[model samples]
Target: MYTPPAFRDDDKDSLIATIRAARLANLVTATADGPLATPLPLFLDETEGEHGVIHGHLAKANPQWRVPAIGDGLAIFMGPDAYVTPAWYATKQETGKVVPTWNYAAVHAYGPVEFFEDADRLLEVVTRLTNLHEGARAAPWAVSDAPPDFIQSQLRGIVGLRMPVVRLEGKRKMSQNRNAADRAGVASGLAASERPSDREVAALIS
Candidate 1:
């Protein structure tokens, strides 16, 4: 989150895009006991609130929900990332002054956290989340595919969460601080990497 001016991303669309692209996110909250974090598949309900609302669920056994949060909760979403070797920097060849770095996109959303056990709301949340992830598949599944009693029992085992986003912080460190030549070198190097994630980062270098 310590984004330099050159790497700061204040564009709303860009921030939302990073969040949507992230298949999983980390939810963190400060508590009297300590800090707790859960990796979850969260979705943003863009129609709600000023910034929007985040929706997800946690296992009922997860103590994070039982412990009262002292302040706003944070949800972290990360996009494509790759390690950038100094060898990819033209400055390394020219002046040997460049060091290794990382290129990635990330978003942090902060807001009050609410956990609920309402069966109806839990059912809605699970259904929507399932559709969001399965929409792209050829044989997309649905909550209705399962028996209602079974789904209800499953819902009883988890708690739904909602966080109306009060703030959003985005960072895109894609060689923006580097000179054009160095950036081009980085793009090319990453594009040639066998790692698909590196290639994905290469596409975002501009």
Candidate 2:
């Protein structure tokens, strides 16, 4: 990520918060054939290693897991994002020098990738992942709700992945480069937008 100093986020807590807020992430790896990516629901285990460990699963049929990655794999997580119109900038009226840009938050995590098929480990991963997402629901569900045989069969169709994060790059481009007046203009404009995501970004402007 090309993050300017004003937009760079090096706070470990902030980086983890961004990752946890992301409902889905893109897992990318370089291979001899080419680059392959899969959209996955990944979770970070902060207790694991120096940086942290990421856990997720991919369909067994997905060739990305079978291919040997040339180097560390990357997991991309994105937070609220919105397009900022130049019209929202106070500088636009003052000097007409402002151009449109995007405001967003993102994190890129790099680490060695490990794909596994152990049934016990797969079950543990899936169970934890399920609980993580479902715990907030009014009527939460569990893996034990299903028949053991059925769950085992389902697990057989997917492969689990583990990655211990070696590097974490976080960017929060939320009008930090703009002057206070221009940032307020952007926040006001975004807060009025119909898209909920825009309003979410507006809250981060300050």
Candidate 3:
């Protein structure tokens, strides 16, 4: 991810938190044809492995699952991000030597990838994913909510994915490189923004 020392985040908990905060992520794998990527809703099992195991599923027709992975796959998780204007830097007024940049948080996990079609395992993955996304809803839905025959038919159309994380890399660029005055300006400016992501980044800065 080319993270500089100042921007690198090595804290395991912080890295996992960023992954959880990202509602969606991209899974990338190298292949003989080229690099293939898929946008997916992946869940992490923090209790497993030194890092954790990632779980998700793909459409049965997805070519990504059919392609043989050359090496470890990379799953990218992105958190809150915001644009930082040069105007948000005190140095812009003091020396006019500032430029625009971005502030954001992200995590990259690498691991061997596995694709499967076992109905029992697929059912478990589907149920867990559904529950995770619906956990906070007043009227939560479940795989069991549907007819067993219907659910079984639906499961036939998809495949499951598992990746036991071998390593994790995280970066949090929240104006920590800036002077105190500039950092304050960035936080305040973002806080005033109407964009929810900007405001989220503002909270991280503070």
Q: How many backbone clashes does candidate 1 have?
A: 0
Reference-based TM-score, model 3: 0.98
Off by over 4 Å in 3: none
- For residues 43-132, what per-residue lDDT tens digits would candidate 2 score against the true structure? 999999999999999999999998899999999999999999999998999999988999999999999999999999999999999999
lDDT of 3 by residue, 55-127 (tens): 9999999999999999999999999999999998888999999999999999999999999999999999999
Q: Which stretches of candidate 2 lie over 4 Å from their true place?
A: none
TM-score of 2: 0.99
lDDT of 1 by residue, 1-110 (tens): 79899999999999999999999999999998899999999999999999999999999999999999999999999999999999988898899998888999999999
- Candidate no. 1 TM-score: 0.99
For model 2, which pairs clash?
none
Give each model a TM-score: 0.99, 0.99, 0.98
lDDT values, one for every candidate: 0.97, 0.97, 0.95
Root-mean-square deviation of candidate 3: 0.7
